[model samples]
Target chain A: MIPNLTLAVVAGVLFATGVYLLLARSITRALLGIVLLSNGANVLLLVAAGPAGEAAFYGRTPESDMSDPLPQAMVLTAIVITLGMTAFILAMAHRSWQLSQTDIVADDVEDLRLVELAVRDVAPHDEERPDVDDDAAGDDRPPGPGTDAVVEP
Target chain B: MTGIDWDILVPLPVVLALAGAGVAVVVTGRIRLQRAVSVVTLSLVLVVALALLVGADREGPLSVTVGGWPARMGVVLIVDRLAALMLVVSATVTLGVLLYSIGQGAASTDEERADEQAPLPIFHPTMLVLSAGVSNTFITGDLFNLYVGFEILLASSFVLLTLGGSAPRIRAGISYVVVSLLASVILLSAIAMLYAATGTVNMAQMAERLDALPEGTRLVLQLMLLVAFAVKAAVFPMFGWLPDSYPTAPAPVTAVFAGLLTKVGVYSIMRTQTLLFPGDQLTELLMWAALATMLVGILGAVAQDDIKRMLSFTLVSHIGFMLFGVAVGTAAGISAAIFYVAHHITVQTTLFLVIGLIERYGGTTSLTRLGGLAKLAPVLAVLFFLPAMNLAGIPPFSGFLGKAGLLQAGAEQATWLAYLLIAGSVLTSLLTLYAIARVWSRAFWQPPIEPATEGLERVPRGMTLPAAALVAVGLAITVVAGPLFAVTDRAAADMLERAPYIDAVFPGGVP
Candidate 1:
């Protein structure tokens, strides 16, 4: 039989810890949390497959009594994918750190601010604006939306 | 799951071979050698892809298992008309981009000098890895394998998207990374839940089992999977990350991504919704999402001066057209969506490549910084006009044909959703026309200004030729619409009727 309350509690604790770290600002912590969460999910999947009384190593035959191996194989694949992604994320974090001198999102407000500036800079009306000649051609749609006005700051 | 034979899975090895070559090129690190290797590897993959397509076209659907394991036991790769067609399209676009990138040579950005020590020849390897991942995704028969394929592509794409290492690229790359990782997490969780519920990862088998599950549980699980794919496909609200981040990448990188990557997401959604859960309820949700995606994408497109950014938004918008077809839950609708996807893949890539050419020749991609390109480069003008107009769904073009097919299918569905699709499509087309017209008026038709001419430079033969070649292909598709439509129609038919696929995998029955 499965380890009942102990295994459930451990899986729950792992999931909670993972969720906490994943929400953190630090990329490294987030990566670590993904790993933990995946492991937790693996355990949960195993428990869902029914009782896990004994290790597969103890039982030579899977037909008689053994924890399912499919979930284990899936977990193995998940771990490999996680490792590859973690490496890529670390590289990205390093690059972000080098470029902006900070890995935190708040420090990279320049680009976000640029888009706002661009939106505001577009003049409300131009000769190309459809409303210039559409007084008699009153439309239900928003006025400027139809105009092929220039959109550069 | 029984009619499919177990012998048609040779494309996997071919895909891995190219991936291995890319790894070798990166490890070797000699720039000249890497370039040569990339060209050879890409061309080889293209040839193999073509062969696979032709072979499958003649012999029908095929499947092969890892080692000797059964479909439920080990990884399975299946090839049918749809998969073969996607492989060929992906390889062709990749081949073109590989040629263009190799000819363009080393990038000339200040960031390259600053970060020269970390990695060398970043683009070539990443592109190869991405190709392998795309190929794997298209061919794989299991859900978890598809997840792995997505991770492979996403991780490599993060590298390619930020290849230049500029401030904007890095910033955009960060958002792209976070959003993509979140999607992956959601997808993985869905896989976990599905596995827990069914104990199998094979898609065909799961399709059979999914019907037996309680409707509530299945609906929740399917919704999770749909949300994840939607994020990857950049549909409507999930699309915020696309236009900003896609425009930050180098042109060749962006072009290949536009051609293949998001379509893979669309492809997966199509597969799952059409084959596994053919219900009427999700179609309504998809219809609303399609309407929003079309309108929002075009609206964003209208508000952009940057050609790349505008095109990126339009990319988001056009996804709605495809989803509209798939959302109808009719044979006609799925067929049209398939046709639309194939057409959009080639047409969009050609447009992006042309835009890159425009940026190179005209000095900037922004309308404010560009003017009088037609006077200086008439050939480039023709190149840009064809795909741009086609993308806007002008008549006598493949884009128009595909859009008409989708519209026809939408009408045939004859529901409130159908009317919504029809209206949304017309609006999206008009906005698309306006966006392309804006680019044309500013970048091509307008008279030259003094400062702009001073910055204007001759387009390099390296860049111009690829753009020219792509324009030719785009035009050929338009001119030969009848034949192309037949191919797309057949591919669509094969996809909608999943028996060929299920049969190829099972060979007897799925029992």
Candidate 2:
């Protein structure tokens, strides 16, 4: 069966652009990237169906004239999955924005701490390990008397 | 012989879990009822899965076409030895983890506040959906259906990972979601290409058709599938997302994800390799990948200060052992890999659950803050110690048996690369021991850094009981090692032969 060159090219473009956007630091851009990549995949599925012919309804079209119905069915499933995932990611992005007031994805705190230790050439398990515990505990600790004294002054 | 229709039960694990999820969602406000629904559902799944395992082993394989559709035209759910084994192991762990989480939920919040508090009402339904996804992947005979199964689990995992919309979890979830999505896209593209080449996505039919393709085209298709599965499996160079994301989730979430998710990827790799590819073309490449995954993952583990993250790294490392077995490309090797997968799933989940107890008892997971736990909580120490030793491949534990099997398989292969992998496996085992020993000394044996904090409530028995039960299950594996090995041996032989699976799916031969 002859393949669809135009659709293949479009899928290629979509993949390239999608990957480019996917590498961005912003969550919104990454979500768009996922959307584009899934669409690209969907298009590739379409291209896999070969040259278009009569719609695949049996009895309505002769068997030989019908386009491959399987890939079309697959493409539909991919579209629905992509739509669901897109909605989920959008909700996550919105939640991230609500919590951080920034759309940029944050670095993992533990990973960042490891990096900081590496930059300082200190072993992570060493007793001299940086007191980064402050970051984790800062949110939960009650206010100290020193802070209250300064405020009273 | 008993007149039981075992064929009808092949799809029950997935169907039951999914239907249970719907019922669970309906009973959202009634926490006890929701929990009962999930437990009952998974218990039923365990029963069905056990029956399938026995039937598949005794009968070769059992298959059912969904909705009575023709095998060539519709989805198939086939339970051969390999799939049945996976179903049984996964069902056990999901049930175990669910009970542990229920216990944890009770301990962390009083019943009056449970309806409005954490462990949110969404957990039970999502957990059931996740189980259904995992079971679906294990049993699916259609490639596209396998993709759907993956999406089902992944979507649920995303929700579980970021449950409660906490800031740290959301940060981790973003990376996890993106990486998993990318893998899904690649897997989809590969399936499309395979369908284009073979004209069908039914694995049995594709197995027949793939052989007739030109070598280059077949190789390309194989590589595409490998890349997708490798990322999901968290193999070397693609595993960055795992260590960063897994440790931030709630303990039970982390446990279940660590236990089952990567193994699902490994399971798919094994299926595609044995059934579809069935050659030594990529075995060398996989062997090298296995070596790297083992060494790098353990080294990362050795450097971690947090117990959860350290275990997460070790989890990645053990995936390499399974990969090594698969790479050996022999019946013995594949059997060892299957056993390793089952052993790892139980031990890893148990360890994580124990760590959850550790976190609660010590008021932290950081090694620096934890001390004198052996004296303070002897039961918790034993709970941690048994699995820790098992994970470190101590003799008489399933971990040691699994590793010894892989090492012996590698030796039997006797290729230079296989020898190298054997050495790598041994070294990784040593490092795992070292990592566990360090945690033991620092967290349990060391003197308290600050005297144990006062008013710390005793660990609820509800939580400890399930964790203890899982530990006992880990030991039980060792006790039954011989029989388990025989089962895995039969399963491996069948997988390598490939006929049992194909014949089950298409008894009349590929149309």
Candidate 3:
């Protein structure tokens, strides 16, 4: 069976742009990337159905002339699954915005801490040293007498 | 063979869990009812899985075409020895984790509940759905069905991972979700290409047709499938999201994910490699990947101070051992890999659950802050100690047996790469021991930095019981190792021969 070059090219472009958007720091863009990527995959599935023919129906089309029904079934299943996931991710993005007022993905805190320790050239074993002047440690400390005294009580 | 109809049972595990999930959701906010539904559903699945295991071992592979469609035209669910064994082990662990989570929910104080989003009522349903997804992946005979199974599990896992919608979890969830989506897209595209080439999505049909394709096309398809599965399996370079995302979730959530999700990926890799692309075409590449996964994962584990992160790293490392067995591409190798998957699932989940207990008892997972835990909770110490040693490949344990099997398989292959992997496996084992030893010495042996905080409750029995049961189950695997090995050996032979699976799907031969 001959393949459809035009549809294949469209799928490739979709994948390329989807991956580019996926690399962004913003969660909303990442969600859009997933949408595009799944759409690209769906298009590829349609292309995999091969050259178009009459709609697959029991009595309407001869066996040899009917288009493949399997790929269309698979593409529909994929689309539904993607729709569900898109809704879930959208909910998560809203929740993230509510929590932090921004949906930009943040670096892992533990990973960042490890990076900071490496930058300071201090062994992880010595991380507990009181005199090390750790910024994270300072942040965890309760506010001093001059600031937030009423909030503490 | 027996009077019971085994073919009908192939889909029961998936069906039961999914139906139970629906019931669980309907009973939401009624915690006790929801819990009952989950427990009963999983327990039924376990029984069904056990029956399938026995029947498959005794009779042969059992399959049922969905909606009464012919094998070539419609979806099929088949349960051979490998799939049945996976179903049994997964059901067992899901039940164990479910009980532990229920215990944890009961024991948590109201203030603790308010702090972390109250262990949302949605947990039970999602967990059940995850189990269904895992079972579906194991039993599916259609490649596209396998993809659907993956999405089922992944969607549920996304919910489980970020149950509370807290800042840290959302942060972790975003990365986890996007990476998983990317993997899914890649897998879908690969399926499309395979369909375009082979004209069928049924795995048995594909297995037959793939051999007639051009060598380059076959190789490209194989590599694409491998890349997608490798990400899910957490092999070397693709594993960055795992250690970062897994530790932030609540304990039981992390435990189930650690136990089953990655193993699903490994299972798919084993299936596709042996069935559809049966040759030594990519064995060397797999060996190199296994070696890198082992060494890098263990080295990361050694550097971690948090027990959760350390165990997560170790989880990634042990996946290498399974991959090593797969790379060997011999009967002995695949058998050992299967055994290792079962052993690792139990030990890893037990370790995580015990760590949860530790966090509750000691008030922190940080080694620097935790001290004198042996004196405070000797039972918890024992629970933790046994699994840690097992994970580190202590003798007379299932872990040791599984590792020894892989080592022996590597020795039989005796390629230079196999030797390199054997050496890597031993070193990784030793480093694993060192990592566990460090945790023991620092957390239990050292004196308390300060007196235990007042009102710190004793580690609740409800939580401890399930963990101890899992530890016992791990030990039980060692007790039954001989028979288990025999079954896995037969399973491997069947997988490699390819006749049993293909003939089961198309008993009359391909049309």
Candidate 4:
């Protein structure tokens, strides 16, 4: 039987990679990060159930020697949930491509501006943009929505 | 040993919401019919919740063990004072938000073209599903069932958040979904660990088994559970997604999200801390988080010039107040936290709905563009004013009462951290007051910076009525704070002592 150590180590590797990628600037990499992270969590869930013993089906093995079925069931449910989430996120990433040119998760304009201010140690700048002011009671810079300075091609 | 009477009530709220969702989906083409179904389902849920509250209060905790499986093998639904009280409050808030959404939806359908209102048909069904998820989270006795409830809510919210199909909504939805999915994965893994550490997932059974575990192991499990929940609750250091995500959703979606979702996380923390890992082993950590969340959240609020972002930060800040009470580990503190959650849900949702009105009337939520609103829409001004002050913990409001009770509890403990939290709580409240005042002065008091290019539309009666109703309900909580606190105190007492809950489930001695 595979020991908990191997499982845990693999899980750790997956998690480390996932987190590293998650911190990446690209949305696709972040999506990949989510996939790896969820899979790692699933593996950990299995490890949490202890070393495998016997088949889950009744009469195939004595009940005492049977592997815990709850975690398996939980893992199944988690996998399904992760599937749905991944698909949804993929759609969002696709939409980002359609609407804008890039697949990077841009920070909202306010977030980007704050980062800009910190880096340059300069005062804020207000710039005009498309989209925010639609009607008559417009003209205020409603933060020009989200974009990252570093994310530009 | 299971009584069939309360057994039926345990699943009723969730069942009604889901069944209603099913019917609403079938009637989705007709927005009017869908609205009718949504209202009826939530209203029925509210009525059932009130009955559950009365039953639980009068008859101690009632439980239903699913499928008659032996003790640790099956799911259990518990209706205790704490669960019942949360059920009632959550149902009330969801129902109020549903009505408000209908109003907003109807208003938009009347004015906007096809593309804008395209998603309105599905909104009612999804809203029902969200309500079911919330109800399930509150009532379920087992941990995995609660996780299922969270998933239900998360899926529905993922849809609701991106309803408008606008760029910002999708961007914000991506953040929301990613954060929530991460939290769900962590929560599932933690449950697996908890089940492995103990031999069961039935909470009562696990509590008994976990008592025998090594101290270090118990602490590990406790921390895992806490971290998982902290992410959901938007506690400090884990709340990065909230302000970014919530402010971009449609108003009703944001209102409901602001009102209930994070509170469900807080509710779970309360439950687990009291049941499986009782006492103050994690109190020090929770206390620091409490202080940090309050201070950081309020400071975020102060820095925002947009109404939605400002309100979102205030929401984060106020969660700190509830966590503070939980950290205190005293009956008064826990009760006060519960009371504060109730007050915050109503006031937060009301403020968001009011902001929706302001956005509509002024054509923007940016404080820089908004002003002379008090002169234009006095009804809207009053609606915004009452809840804004209430949220800031103004006197004679439930917010003030809840904070006062929490501060009194912390002071009684007399710990240095508790004292620091006390000071933090007061400072946070004042800062919140200042933040709202910034909005008031810039948006309502000052004359409009520019002449109106178009006349402001009178807010639809439907919209104002629901917002006003919630504000009045908040006022009712203040006016009747005495009885409410008494109920809260009793609920808190029942929650802190695990014996009654366990005994009710197992009949005789705990398993």
Alpha-carbon TM-score of each model against the true structure: 0.88, 0.94, 0.94, 0.93
Model 4 Cα shift for residue B477 (angstroms): 0.8
DockQ of each: 0.28, 0.64, 0.61, 0.48
For residues B27-146, could you state the per-residue lDDT of candidate 2 as single tens digits? 998989999999999999999999999999898888899999999999998998889989999999999999988988877756533532345589999999999999999999999999
Tens-place lDDT digits, model 4, residues B414-450: 9999999999999999999999999999888999898
TM-score of 3: 0.94
| Position B461, candidate 3: lDDT | 86
* Candidate maximizing lDDT: 3
- Output per-candidate TM-scores for chain A, rounded to 2 decimals: 0.59, 0.75, 0.76, 0.73
TM-score of 4: 0.93
How big is the positional error of residue B401 in model 1, measured in Å on the Cα after superposition? 0.4
Scored by CA lDDT, what does every candidate get?
0.77, 0.90, 0.91, 0.85
Question: Which model is ahead, 2 or 3, in terms of lDDT?
Answer: 3
Model 1 off-target regions past 4 Å? A1-41, A57-59, A106-153, B1-9, B13-29, B106-119, B450-452
Ranking by lDDT: 3, 2, 4, 1
- The 10 consecutive residues of candidate 4 chain A with the worst lDDT sum are A121-130
- lDDT by residue (A99-140, candidate 1, tens digit) is 657656432333444544544443344345755435423322
- Candidate 2: the clashing residue pairs are none
Candidate 3 local Cα displacement, residue B26, angstroms = 1.4
> What does DockQ come to for candidate 3?
0.61
Residue lDDT tens for model 4, A43-145: 9888888888888789778998998888888788888988988898888888878887777776764676575554343222222432322321222333333
Ranking by DockQ: 2, 3, 4, 1
Q: Lowest-lDDT window of 10 residues in candidate 4 chain B?
A: B110-119
- Candidate 1 CAPRI category: acceptable
Q: Point out where model 4 deviates above 4 Å.
A: A1-3, A115-153, B1-3, B109-120
Worst 10 residues of 1 chain B by lDDT: B1-10
